[model samples]
Target: CLGKEVGADIPFCVYQKVARVRGIGDIVEPFKLKVGYDVLLIKPKQGVDTKIAFEILDLDKCPHPDINQVKKALINNEPLKDILGNSLLYSAEKLVPEILDIIKECKERGYEDVVMTGSGSTVFVLLEKGQDCRDLIKFMEGKYPFVYRTSILIK
Candidate 1:
């Protein structure tokens, strides 16, 4: 409610299946890119929710950090020198507050474990009841363009 805008990209990108998460080398399954925005990380209908999907990994976001360093580390297939590059990828720093607002909203709605996915527009929220999750998203759709779907954690 702080701002009049909802996640702007959800509508167009929601139903459109984007690219899959890179790496994994075959043991893992391929997933599509259903989201990309500030503060939130959403999983479209085709895959597991990013929250659970990325949970095992030490993932995070940042205000202004060295993305190139992080990418270089990843590209070289070396264990991240700074594993928790929370501030590395910050293409949307101004959106931090927006993300926080969304997280706050999620907390207010009773979700306790909300996490930013890969420093992006997708956000995964841990839910006790899926209906509540659905309802919260439904409410947001009335306010701004958004995507809605249910997915697994690791699939």
Candidate 2:
């Protein structure tokens, strides 16, 4: 794993719900999710720089979701409605306005668990378990530069 090669103590290299002690290279632990969610990731031509994203972030206005609540929701397979959100979404959306349009499009299509992953332009729509996203992927591929169908890594 890159974390191990870099001398960071961590259990996994890549996965969701990963908690780092002091961010990135710090002590990291990957939390296992009970239910795997089929997801459609759509990214526009524009990309947001991670550093610039964080630099413009306003913690005062951005959401501060409870990490513990998010972890519990994932582990217990609970509905993610008010509990899951990204702190960097505000800054990312500011950098790339396409992010908002993508999210709105997803919600308009009846997908509720839409969120901007990490720092940028790529937005993901979490589908119900075992739900097929081929139609969504096909629709998104026509609009966005990059559209992919993937799932959460649940162990």
Compute the lDDT of residue 141 as modeled in candidate 2: 88
Model 2 bad stretches (over 4 Å): 1-22
- Give candidate 1 regions above 4 Å deviation: 1-96, 128-131, 153-155
Clashes of 2: 0
How does candidate 2 fare on TM-score?
A: 0.82
- Please, what is the whole-model Cα lDDT of each candidate in the order they appear? 0.42, 0.77
Model 1 C-alpha lDDT versus the unseen true structure: 0.42
Best by lDDT: 2
- Model 2 steric clash pairs: none
TM-scores of all candidate predictions against the true structure? 0.39, 0.82
True lDDT of residue 153, candidate 1 = 33
